[model samples]
Target: MVDKGGSDTVFRTEERFRQALPDPASMAGWTPRSANAEIEEAPEPAANCGPDADWYCARIARGEANFEAVGEEAQFDLTAFADRSAAQDACRKEKTWSAKYTEAQVPPVPGVDSHAYYRNAGGLDGLNLFMCTGTVVAQVLLEGEGSSLDPATAHSLAQLFASRIHKAAAAQ
Candidate 1:
């Protein structure tokens, strides 16, 4: 009887399942030092902004340096794509299909739900990533046919796309 947000609960559970994850304070392999009882330190001074300065940013900015500043070459610009229209047209073309298969068609394998599945496939690079939502389990399957993409590559690509989707969905 889980609600609409149950996927988040399941995701959180999976994160917690990561073996031997460290505590927040002792994150990864770093152990932060305890706070001292000495007198409070003064706040750091701000940096200068000049007319000659090309760009200014912060990492945790202090003094004359901006830690988070990106160099000119490192700056991101979407103008790299000369044929934006063609790229957009290609992306807009989504290849999708669905089928209702008989129960006998499904293998009697463990860990795979055979109750029902409505699959949808579409992605860039002709990547065969399927979203299968069934009565028992909701699964994402990435398969590749022919010499285009191997199973391992397809699986990795699927994981990358899945991660992007998960991130976008979380933001909503």
Candidate 2:
């Protein structure tokens, strides 16, 4: 998880995070699976996370423990969570990139705390990136027909998204 190290400047609204979303147009031919980019909520804490987690993800992130963990293997810890935060924490660990993907060279993204790149580890088909800037963590996955997204493309996309996050962060 790419969380802010000691900063509290979390992107709590989609509008704020929207400024940091990568423009899909930057990738040639490949189109977004959804018309809009999505936001991921922070790791759920048993105690309310200061101000109720990132509002951007709060609205869209499903609030139930019944959600399935999408990956090569089924997740055992998904069910029976006490609340949304517990479920989200468990779910994040079982996610495809976390559970079934292998690490590759992370692209050089400027002005960010840290970042990582991942590719399908087994039967999966996608390239994933998890990055942090300030108090926000962005999880990016690019998948398409036939073969998974190429490294060159993933690198370019990572840079694109990072630049957006960097720009918005600078303005703040």
Candidate 3:
């Protein structure tokens, strides 16, 4: 049995501690003959074979217990990307020119017709993948468009983008 949230379900029965919680997909993966043979041999009948209130409560308790023990597996910080307003201004100016330059360099991807947009995003772990990708592309434009911002600021921005990608991948 498993919870509606797809967590392992807990059951108390005559087998009690002897029966390890069964994962549905994994159990299903086992030879059907094996599982059916075990079922036929059991002294007690199965209860709550599907997700139910009891299963949900048990799963929540288990997850909360694990969470209390280990904490979230990933973290993202965007504060390091802040306080670069001058760099941002330079980026915006460069973007204006870069758009014209890129438009001139490549016509358009076949069967694709749309203008690209540049946006600045700010936040901590609330940031998403789209924001991270845009920041990296923006960094490239800043460098190529002759921005006056120092290399250190550019490097910091790149680090922020890289860290965001790492955190997202870890979370997944």
Top candidate when judged by lDDT against the true structure: 2
Q: What's the CA error at residue 56 for candidate 2, in Å? A: 12
Q: What is the clash count for each candidate, in the order shown? A: 1, 1, 0
Off by over 4 Å in 1: 1-127, 132-148
Q: RMSD for each model, in Å, please?
A: 20.0, 9.7, 23.2
- Residue 18, candidate 1: how far off, in angstroms? 29
Top candidate, metric TM-score = 2
- Minimum summed lDDT over a 10-residue window in model 3 is located at 60-69
Q: How accurate is candidate 1 locally (lDDT)?
A: 0.22
Candidate 2 — worst ten consecutive residues by lDDT sum?
A: 71-80
How well does each candidate superpose onto the true structure, as a TM-score?
0.23, 0.52, 0.19
Tens-digit lDDT track for model 3 on 36-120? 1011122211122222222111111110000000211111111111112222232333344435422212111211121222223
Tens-digit lDDT track for model 1 on 1-172?
A: 1111112212122222121111233232323222111111332111332223222110111111001111100000010011222222212221111234211122222222112222334432222333211111122222222223334433433343234323422443
**lDDT for each residue of candidate 2 in 1-172, tens digit (9 for 90 to 100):** 4333323344444554555554344444443333333344453443553333433222222111011112211100001223334434433443433544466566645554443445544555656655444444445555433544556655665566667655654556
Report every candidate's CA lDDT. Answer: 0.22, 0.43, 0.22
Better of 2 and 3 by TM-score: 2
Candidate 1 or 3, higher TM-score?
Answer: 1
